[model samples]
Target: MYAAGLLNYSEHPMKVIIDTDAGVDDAVALFLALAAHKDPKCPFEIIGITCVLGNTGVDNVCRNVFTVLDSTGVSNIPVFRGADTPLVQPFIRGESPFFGVDGFGGVHSLPNIPVVKQERTLEKESAPLALVRLAREFQGELTVVALGPCTNLGIAINIDPNFVKNVKELYIMGGNSHGVGNIRPCVEFNFFVDPESAFVVLSAAWNQKIVMVPLETCKLAMSSMEWRKQVLGTIKSSCSISLKKGLLQRFEKDYGSWCSCDAVCMAVLLKPSIISKSSTNYCTVELQGAHTRGQVVVDHPQKTGKPHNVTIIEQIQLAELERMLLSTFHPSTFI
Candidate 1:
């Protein structure tokens, strides 16, 4: 796959921009990214973080991102605010039920944690436009890790036709591989919230891999809450400690089974080998049917002669995930 003089990624730091809606798990993903960035051996460098509407309103998401950064003592990465609403509909008002009222399990209200608003961010630049600018600046060296609805990314593609070409790759955490839905009968939450944008991002010809860690694949991380609360909770590290604060309410809510949907995406990004099984298929979001809107329709039969647009991860190694989680939560175990 080497073209003439193209430099290998190992030769330079692979630039990454995290586009997220700061839910509880989104905070976990950010903690993982921050840990990787601190490592000297890691090949990727986080350039910036973008906010979009998803688990909560865009404004809340932006604030929540700052909260994570503040909690982790990271001040360099610039947070860019993006689309407050989906492509077709206005964003849902008020906080979501999953991540408590404040999206971080009301962590900001905790006495130990200070209220952190949008700080140390590029307020002038919009998120979608920022994505376009970053892609051109980094050229083929940039990877966009999407952790929420595809609204911001879709707008970026619409902004610049060359966006997909300039960017090296995309890693998304959304959709459902088995037609199982969290928000609707056949639709996943992120896609269900914004089907138009999901369809747009999936249909594009990126010239690089679009690795999607859908719901079914993500559910593989639901192994043991005991391991999470005890093993991982005992790990005394800045990242882990900070993440624990965000996950306080979650432990009681989803106690028996534990699954950080977005964190699985981060783990896959950190170590692709963890993906023991995957299927490269033509994947698209359904936007028309009354009950089927936002469902991910994968061409498993290979009837669509079109080139595969996305690599749908079917399974991951749970053992490998545990190893990566250790490294992510405790940076010293990066080996």
Candidate 2:
């Protein structure tokens, strides 16, 4: 009983570093992780947040990150600014009408949400360097959840050749499968934003494990509009007043179905069983080609000589995922 208690104490609050571009969905992901920090079943203690350029510029990303933290009443999580552009690639800004300029769908700030004053200032160290230092500090237990372009991670790998191998694992929300793409005919937004960085991260050797939750997985695992309305309909009664108001503001301008894409990565970390189907494969990005420039080329080891370097998630349990997402937004509930 004593040994079991010790084990339970050590594992509940898993240490994590969230590297994101801080879009609307990334805000949802951050809130979910913060909520999980309070869960007894499978909590996540956020070590820090590293912001990179993707959905918006690094400045806007930083603001969005801090804004989410403030709204959630989380005061001590350090925020770090990362790479402003992809390595060896020129930045061609992709205008996301849904995400808007400020990266929170242009909603900026919501009233009625209690804002936590900044207690933890931005770290002096840059994102990539901080990642390297943190990996050494936590060694065998740090899990990095990347919700943006892979620039920061690729920089870390380049700076310290062993950086990739030192982390416990990487939960990446990028890439696509079956040649399906969200941004272009053959490219996902994250990989399209920075193909060179994506190539570096996917090609980097890892000592532990790497899980890629691509665009396809999110499309399949998204909460249907019916389910979203049914669950969010109870937000007023189920959640705290402040949290309810915050959710309402964020969801007010929704389209059909609400797929918290970035949040899916966090959910997978909180409950690994949500992923119903996955496979290990070697992935590389195309650096040239008018239409296929940023496309990801996934190669199966069984069919090719390349080594399988990443676990690509193809599908997840939809119903279970819906439950997890709902729980993620509810402060009283645990995923």
The digit string of per-residue lDDT tens for model 2 on 1-335 reads 01111112234446899999988778767766776665455456888899999888998899878777766666668899899988997777755434666666555554554445565567888999999999889987889999999999999999998787679889999988667787787788998889989888888888754798888888787565656667643553112222333344434554346677887887787777777889888787888879887787887536667777888888887776666555555534422
lDDT of 1 at 226: 72
Model 1 ranges with Cα > 4 A deviation: 1-12, 91-96, 109-119, 241-255, 331-335
- Deviation from native of the Cα of residue 57 in model 2, angstroms: 0.9
Please report the TM-score between candidate 1 and the true structure.
Answer: 0.88
Count of clashes in candidate 2: 0
Clashes of 1: 0
- Pull out the clashing pairs in model 2: none
lDDT by residue (1-335, candidate 1, tens digit) is 21111211133466899999888889888877776675666677899999998888788898888877766667778889999889887645444467766566665534443433434655689999999999999998899999999999999999999999999999999999889887777788889888999999998889775999998887766757677777766766444434553565555565456777898898788767677899888889888989999999988888989888898888888876666666566634322
Give the lDDT of residue 237 in candidate 2.
19
For candidate 2, the per-residue lDDT at 203 reads: 83
